[model samples]
Target: MIIITAILQMLRNGFVLSKTVIFIWGLVLSHALVSNGVVDVFADFLGDEKYNLWKAIMVKSFLEGLSAVLKVAVIHVSEAYIGRFKAIIFCTGSFTMGLVLLWIRASHLDIVTLIFAIVLIALGTAGKEPTLRDFFDYQLREKVKKNCTEKNEGEDKEPSQEKERSGKNDSAATNLWWSTASIIGSVIASFFLSSDHWGENFEISSIVMGATCLLFIIGIFCYYPEEKPSESPLTIPYRVFKAAIKNRRLSYPSSKQDYNNEDSDDASSEDFFYRTENGEVHLLPRHPSFSLFLDRAAMMNNSDDEEKVRKEEVCTVVQVRDVKNFCLIIPLVVTLFSYNLVSTSGNTYFVLQASTLSSYNIGAFDVSIMALFAIKSLITFVVRTIQSRYKVVRPLWSIAVGMFFSVLCCIAAWQVERRRLYLKKPDDDIPMSIMILTPQYFLLGLMEGFAEGGLKNFLSDRLYSESMKNFVEPYIEMLLGIGKFSSILFALVFYKWIKDEINHSRLDNYFLVLASLSFVYLGIYIFYAKFKFQRRRVAVPAETIQETIERMDELLQVEVDINQ
Candidate 1:
């Protein structure tokens, strides 16, 4: 009876959680619809008024800036002495409220009305993410710093220049070069694929694909191990950028008088730590390393305690540091083609295979795709749960395997397409089994599960040592926006080139491209894993419990050294 009661209670809680997720999803969906609608309306109005492309661009940019300003203003208002959680809830509420207005007006459907409504909703949603992130990071920083020291009396001091070297310096030039090459190739591919005179003008698409593959090969050759640098004494970039940016001012001290006034007392360095204007309190560590400086800053909202301090503070800060190279650009760009390839793979097979299969319904909206996604989500949840229990298996391995499976699914689809084309069935409704589509979607979902989970953990692990770690949360959110934008680039390119000629064979070829790309990506990741330290563990001295206690007692009695 107790077990039954507990099960009932758990079911109730699950339902509540489901309702909350659905509500949030609906709100986001509504916002997207409204925002896009508004953009379309504005573009139409500009076109009607004969505004040139440059003028339209300027106007859009100005509107975006105005939206940003308004969002920032709201953040400041909400941030006034409020807790981080409250600030985030307030911002999310504001955006949701705007979305609610659009949902209320679902009865009316005019281009101008839709446009204005969406713009208003978007304004409420835009910049809220970054602002909320800033609030969270601010809270985390304070909580972590507070856990180290009990003193609320003095500010924390800045670490020295040597400490700043803990973070990795990924070469921005390499990233930029690779990203540029990919972009140029994409453009060339787009041109060749879209042009009707493809045979005469150029077979540029094939050439671009070949070049991109070559670039990946070159990256493998050029890669080299980076030497680990010695630990620094000081924490660099003491001032958090968000605070400075929010206030719209530089944080540098104005004069020597200001510096002296700030740290007025010259106490014994060993007796008392000096706190800087920023929240950091710096002191020398109790060892021989001159370059080692200890920073004791309160993590926001955390009480001072040893165990909690270890959890809050970054361990092996160098391993987790941020590197701002263009490594992400290629991944971002490739995802566009990847999404396009997967989305169109179904359509391509539909056209090419439908004519051949006698039993299949061609171009039918398989609602099963949605069901499959839900199933995939459930699978991911289970996998993640197991991962929590198991220590060894990482989620990234799943992602790598998922992509490989995707290749297999593509192969299966290609086979179906080839079979249909060759057999030449008499019936118009030649149908392939629904199962053919399942693997593709399942693989995609698996990819999403692994990629999303792994990427978050990877970035979080690395972001702490970044020069701008304090402001990283928001910028990371911004990078997501950039990723989405890159993905959309493929949609535009595909519409331009293959809208008319979207066939099973063409799509088969497309999936082949995606498979090749995924393979190369997997290889690069494997290579990186080989050179990079997977994780760091501290070394402990080996001593029996009895011997250690005896040595401790003797040392207390001033008897002898344990080493001797």
Candidate 2:
């Protein structure tokens, strides 16, 4: 009830409840339905005698994560050209085809067929589910801008604060629904999945997916404006890098006036400062020591007086700032891999280990162990509740907190797995209580709430550009995909550690390795947060490189002192 109230309150504060948002929410339900329902049950359904963890679980997981990384290309390259609607349609087709392939696999029980199906579904969900939600936010903002402008024009009235769109609140509300649907999907899947009922699970997932797709189609036709291929934001980084390389020798002008004069067009050159979503203008640093090559692109004056550089070879001051920030963000994305890599690998292993335990019951019927995977979503829902109640918005620090917990979760898994293995020496089935896994799931839930929710807040709060914000979300998913891709590498690297039977496999060692690397990456995050990200970045007055560095250090010292 509190969650529902939060949703209504958020919508009341200038949310447009657009068709695109509904479509995205539906996509989330469809994906969640299959993931917790079908993926983990593969070995059991296909007969554990024939399939093992390597084939049934790890193989499917690998391709799914790999597909997520691959979706970056599909989203930017293909979606950039064919229009978002067509790209969405193509992804929807893949999702439907995957379910059809799953139905076929049920009969033949082919590994190749199952893998192909998993890839298709992963590509569809990864490419669309998150992407659509972001698009909804973008579209919502655009609509708000339009409506506000029209009202102002008509009445000569100033747009109120309530009329201004709040992306953070709106995004939180969207996440609330998405998380709830995910939990429900997991529970629904449990009822539909047993060894004999696995076929029914896929069949139901296909129907749900199809129904959602139909709804999205109807919504698009009813509400979508005519599609136009906008200039891809992906090209911004390329242009900045290209211009930086071409004009590396050139130095920036002494005055803001000269910078303004260097503008290729009045539109790009309009300001040295960029406006945030809340109407605060942050003036970018004029001459920062870091990435000085980027500063050169802002200088329009050629060293050779008679020589002329092409238009494509130069960008405005604001573009240079945007590009430099983009570069800084890419390295930090590696540290984010710490959590995703651990979760992607640990989740399937958790389910397999759960099956080995004596089944727990609720009254008459036994509960599906896979339903435990829903705990993360449940925690996320709790985070949403706290956020809605308190209006919390600590974006970057929340992410760090999430990463910290993720390392602990990996450690917890390692200890529990080691203990489980120790007790399994005499009997393959140790009759261990399922309660042993509860703490791991509990920690995972905290990680999900902070890490995932924090990422959402970070995007809505820190990022200044709408175009960049939209692209960054997909980029983050790609990072997660890379994390997923690395899981395959880990399994191969520790091949002997993973056996056909859970009892024989030394997975505790595997968890240990993941925890160690995640700990190292967590250290990187702390170092970067303290020294790099927290520092007074390239967003200040025109100053000499030395003065800029000193100022940044001084400001960083203040921040550190405050933290202490």
Candidate 3:
């Protein structure tokens, strides 16, 4: 979707596909090839062949969880030192190396080698993914800006309408393209992994990854370089935290008027609330609610040492607001962990379950279990289209809908498992058709598209400062890592309870537990949506306030639509 979007965007702009865009596309393609095509199958192979069912689940889960953590850590530590492009290249190289290692270890079947390969792959993946996403977003923004500039110059009237239409079309095109690529990757990977005619899946994966690395390198020169930040991006959040702590004793202004009344030494300055050291106005107005203490970070304090005061009060109101926005979104982000806990089981337990059921046959070809994931890609396209068509752009509401789907998926899976358990045979395949589980996969995919899309939109839109926006992808990655890690821990407990007793093991019970947990979190999400983040109506002219309220009400209506 991202690759196609960039291509369409370039086409729309009357520019040839830029080298940078191509390189980014290559990165995305390579990622799909490895992640969808190789990794899951390799993990499954190890589990089914080398170890028992429970051990296999643990291996895949542990490797994924650990790798997620490593990726987040590597990105955090290295992103500042190396710019996003370089970081992406570094990750791609690491992943390629890991693939090579996996190929070498294939015959030996050394667990240690496999572990090392997993770690390296994880590190590479973690580093590249967030940076890649941010890069795409950066490109999209630039494209939009360029289009707006052109529209403003070329068409004086209807620029807003044209821009809106163009933006929607471009976004839809990109999403469709991304989904298509993912589906292709999934199908290709499944074929190689499942078919005996394709020499070992690991070998095929290694070759694909190597080619992907080459493509990544080839496109490096084409990328438009972003200016490197003077300070570590990590420092912004830390500075906000420190400044807020320092000003904890300070009191907030009684009213917006009080905030505006404070006179600055510079009479020429018109702005209030927060000013830069050189007396420039900030883009965002002061937000008094939700971590209001952070407002003190931008408050000017009179000190004996002018230099000290300048240094201490340098943080912008926008920056403080950015930090507060992040804080506000943390609870919503944490909800993904619960969603992931249930979702991750799909790749492991669900796949295993499918394998035990009767396969779908189409003449000469038997459908691979991994190919079923294309169902998700399909559902995502449909959902996103419906969303775009109706202008249903409420991200949080989308997330809630996604959560609801996830709960449904769990319930469906539980029922399927319950039936399978009841109809168990000693040595034969389960009587149930693998297609019985298609609904769960479809729901899982819908959950992913909506929840992830919502989360991304929420983070990107809510941020008040452009400077702080780059952190959004990394924050998301960190949250996903946390979720993956937490899921592994939960899986371990569940595995212990079920423990290698294939027939006797009540995996259905685990799914039931997940469904119950999801329900609880869904209710909490509703509460948060309703009470925690209510829109504050700023004091203004009645007409202006009425318009603002109407806009807010429109957004709330979208939420209502999502619930319906």
| Candidate lDDT (C-alpha), each | 0.36, 0.65, 0.66
Candidate 3 residue-wise lDDT, 237-331, digit = tens: 78877876876776654332222222234432323233332333332333434566666666555353246445654465556667877776777
Candidate with better TM-score, 1 vs 3: 3
Task: List CA RMSD, all candidates.
Answer: 19.5, 8.1, 8.4
Candidate 1, residue 184: Cα displacement in angstroms equals: 45
The list of candidate 2 runs beyond 4 A from truth reads 1-8, 11-28, 39-49, 56-58, 77-79, 134-180, 194-196, 256-291, 303-312, 381-396, 425-427, 452-462, 536-564
Q: Which scores higher on lDDT, 1 or 3?
A: 3
Evaluate model 2: give its lDDT.
Answer: 0.65
**Global fold similarity of model 2 (TM-score):** 0.77
lDDT tens string, model 1, 1-564?
Answer: 543543344344222111222222222333322232332123323333344433333344334434544554444344344533344445444444434443454344344644564455445555344443343233223332333233332546343322221111112222222223323333323222221221222123223223332332343332222223222212222222221233233233222221111222433221222223364332212112221221212212223334543443312212211222112223432433343344333322332232232222336433222233334444444443333334134644544454555565566556655554454344434345534545555665555445444444444443434333333333333344343333234434444323322232244454455567656655665554433323211111235445667877877777445445
Off by over 4 Å in 1: 1-367, 388-391, 395-399, 402-435, 461-481, 491-497, 500-505, 532-564
